[model samples]
Target chain A: MTISVLVVDDSPIARKMIRKALPADWDISIQEAGDGDEALAIYRSGGIDVIFLDLTMPRMDGFTLLEKLQQDDLNCFVIVVSADVQPGARERAMKLGAIEFVPKPIDPQALREVLREYGVMV
Target chain B: MSELLLNDDQTAALQEIANIGMGQAGNSLARIWGEFVALSVPRIATVAAARLPELIQRCVGDGRVSAARLLFHGAMRGEALVVISAADRRTLGSLMGFPAPAGDGDPGAQLLHIAETLAGACLGGIARQFEATIGFGAPALIGEDLPARAVVRADTLGVDLALCLEVRFRVEARSLAAHLVMLMPRQEVQGLAVLLDRFLCTL
Candidate 1:
């Protein structure tokens, strides 16, 4: 089965960085969303297997998206990729049902490890 | 700033949080400029709201500065002000693909855009740490003048504690020093200080 991933962030540069950091070896279909609203639309189409989410955005934020995901019981692994590295941020993202939290500027090694831990990569 | 409001532990905790926030802010700039951005160790200060203007002057010194002032609202409410000297403003403008002096349109507007971008980057990073969302008001440009003077003219929000930091940002051969001043109500700051201490204790 081909894995599908969604990279959601307001910054085009950041979204591109996230996409670049993905494991190049995987059979992955990557997607992009600039905000939570767009992300929701993409997510509802049901091809995404993993989501890389960002917290701060203009039209609907990651938090609200997480809430909606929980309410709707969407079964997809979520990894928050954001610049908000404050202590509580990680905790909040975890509490909101994210499987993992990655602080940004997209560390490729970190991304690999997270993907491996979740068995998204062998 | 009569009494030292934050104790040693609290001060250290706040400093750590500020460092994380600044680091994220630096990363944001690095992406924008496509160069490594150097962020200095931030010096955090807790001052009375009434004394904030005085404190700004002391740090800003005699030179006129262009400040971008954006008010933030969330679990805490206040303002985030980024101040840069006029000399640095021209340098940064040119770096951002604008002509030096950025004269195509209102120079103040151009500077204000930079200010808002930088300030948003910094505060957005900080707010994530608190697990809170901070909404920024439309950014207003405070032209070449003392930050305090511009803030006084533009804002009427009652601020009680100002968390001030002197952060130096460098990109390649060019460097710009700017101030990130977060104005919070006394009660809100105290609450944050307490929260920081608790977070540290857990660590």
Candidate 2:
């Protein structure tokens, strides 16, 4: 079984890091977006099961995207992976419907735990 | 110093690192001011003492501006400068608990305190990400509504070309805004590149 993942961030390096962090054993198909607008488009195109999002981006940031998703009742699970590690940030993301808030340069072990907790990986 | 250069990956990594740091800084500012803070994606480049010209242009271009500069040492060594316009300086001054009409208090001291809070949160956030500890020197008010180039203390400027990271923090729905400029000397650039590479490899 394969899970479709979308990694959204303005920094290519961040996207690369997220790609590297995903479990190697999981049958995951990954898509990348540079900002929220692009991620929304990709999600609308279907086949996305999970999203790793960054909050700060050039056009349409993660918070606004969350509002859009909530308004439309988008069903995909979103995990905010950002460098903005502030209590307020976590509160805001969770309030906006993010299932988890992972700090930037996410730890592989912690990421695995989240994936497993969500049953995205065994 | 021969011009220090960063490869594309190194540059991209630095930008992301700066973004994370600045986002946290913005959060700190917003909390204190009781407002939302907007952050610019950090711009990175290797600059010389010439950084002052651009900084002067940015802060003073709008109007009379003030600046406070601080030094940070330990795993990373460099200067952190906070530049704000006169109007924003007044706003930040009031936010820092300086009671009175913003104009009545010492704008210089106010800029220094604001700089400490801003530079501390910003550089502290970056240091944490680098897994390094950094210490700050007392921030000095380098200039206040001063004439061209005076805002930049020419004598205190470092001789080496610097890896300069620039980020802007603007308070939403208010005129309060600041520029946080961090200058990492060329001597530290190689070490920084190693650290960036280490981060890349660990991923």
Candidate 3:
């Protein structure tokens, strides 16, 4: 089975960058969402194994989405992506049940490490 | 009346801080645009609120000017204004591989958004250096005709010293130009300078 991943961000460019950074031969099926509401809708449809979420977005931020997902007991790995690398942002993401926090301008090597640790890639 | 002026040391320190912040902002922009960005050494200047219009006109010269206003509040309080020329905007967009849109309203909005984002990144870098929380308000776009005096209020915000940096950057191998003006209350500037000096001494 292909590893299904959902990428959530308000910026089309940011999403594009993240998509480009992912390994080409990772057997991954990619999905996209512009905000938290769209992400929730896609999550409910099932078959999603991992989520790459952006912190600053309109119509529902990453933290709210993570909270809702946890409250509802939805089973999916979550990775936060944000431009604001303030002191508490990463810590807050971890506390909210995020598997990892990826700083923006996405680094391909960092993505690979996170994917490997999550068992999404070998 | 002559405007209040900073001495040589104060000016140098302020310029150094601005340069560091601009460098960080350039790095952030490069990351967002998915390309390398290089910035020229920043030029520093200071002007009183009353003389701002003439200063802007002289600074911009014959080039077309676009101004965006953002308010930053935290340990350091004031406005962070970004002004870029039309030619520079095209250069920046090209370097980032983003096509300049044709429509008037859309282009204006996009340019203003970019200015706001740049101001946020630059000011955010400065805030990080100072170990402070910075909040940004919405950006307002202004025309060349608008008086700079009207754009910034002197009494309402309680700014002590206004620090401005003229910045130039190249993206995608094209030169782009802009300015970053940060207004800080006098007390904050003195306090911050002392703290930074102490920190540097310890280092």
Candidate 4:
């Protein structure tokens, strides 16, 4: 079965970059969401195996979305994509149940490693 | 209080400096999008934070407005930038070769990404020129009905003054337009002026 993915961010460029960074061989169907509300809607519809979420956004942020998804006990891997690498943001995201925290100005190699760890690709 | 405003010479200097910084940002964006981007002549204006609503309405008018907001924090300065209009976002997206959404999705995300990239490039360029270690938080989408206090707190702390600089741009090939508004604390503004003066003297 092909893995399904959801790319959630408020930036079109970020989503595009993440889309490009994904391995080409993976049989994945990518979907997009702009904010927490939209992401939640997609999650409720099911079939997604992985989520790439942004931290800062309008209407609802990634943190809140993570919280909600965890609260609902939804079964999907969430990897946070953020530029806020101050001090504790990463720890906080991991503690909140995000599988990984990826910094902005994304490095393709890093994304490959994360995807491999999540078993989204070999 | 009137001294907070830029004088003719200072205005001209700022125009030049901002143009240079924005040009650098445009080049970085162009490389990422693979298209040519041009910024309009800078415009200077002074207003209290309370006027932001009217400012947004007037500047954006009826045109669809999409914004990318970046917040900067530091001991020497604090700033907030709002990049406005959807057309500009679409142009940047097209340049990046993002396929149109095949399903229901937030189109705003693409714009936010472009805005974040632009903010990083502009800030990097400005910091390179000033030799300052500026910190940028992240970029987010600004709501049309953004609270005035949110923007006020973004630029000022208690009694500190905020210097607001507005930069507009037009993408000629796409016929799209956008604006970049930077809000820096008063002391940073003064420091920036001094730095600009020094740079000008050398030039």
The DockQ values of the predictions, listed in order, are 0.04, 0.53, 0.01, 0.01
Q: Find the candidate with the highest DockQ and give its number.
A: 2
- How do all models score by TM-score? 0.56, 0.87, 0.50, 0.51
Compute the DockQ of candidate 4.
Answer: 0.01
Locate the minimum summed-lDDT window of 10 residues in model 4 chain B. B147-156
What is the C-alpha lDDT profile of model 4 across B21-53, one tens digit per residue? 565666666566554555444455655555554
Q: Which stretches of candidate 4 lie over 4 Å from their true place?
A: A1-122, B1-3, B74-76, B87-92, B104-106, B144-161, B200-203
User: Per-residue lDDT for A10-91 in model 2, tens only?
Assistant: 9998899888888899998999999999999998898899999999888899999999889878788999998776677788
Better of 2 and 4 by lDDT: 2
DockQ of 1: 0.04
Reported per model, the fraction of native interface contacts reproduced equals: 0.07, 0.56, 0.00, 0.00
- What's the TM for model 1? 0.56
Model 4 DockQ class = incorrect
Tens-digit lDDT string for candidate 3 (A25-114): 889899999989999999999989999998766678787898889887869899987664543557777888999988765688998999
Model 1 segments beyond 4 Å from truth? A1-122, B99-104, B145-161
* Candidate 3 collision pairs: B160-B185, B160-B186
lDDT of 3 at A120: 78
Model 2 chain B: weakest 10-residue lDDT segment is: B146-155
Ranking by TM-score: 2, 1, 4, 3
Give the runs in model 2 whose Cα sits over 4 Å from its true position: B1-4, B59-61, B101-103, B147-150, B153-160
Candidate order by lDDT, decreasing, is: 2, 1, 3, 4
Against the hidden true structure, what lDDT does model 4 obtain? Answer: 0.65
- The candidate that achieves the highest lDDT relative to the unseen native structure: 2
Ranking by DockQ: 2, 1, 3, 4
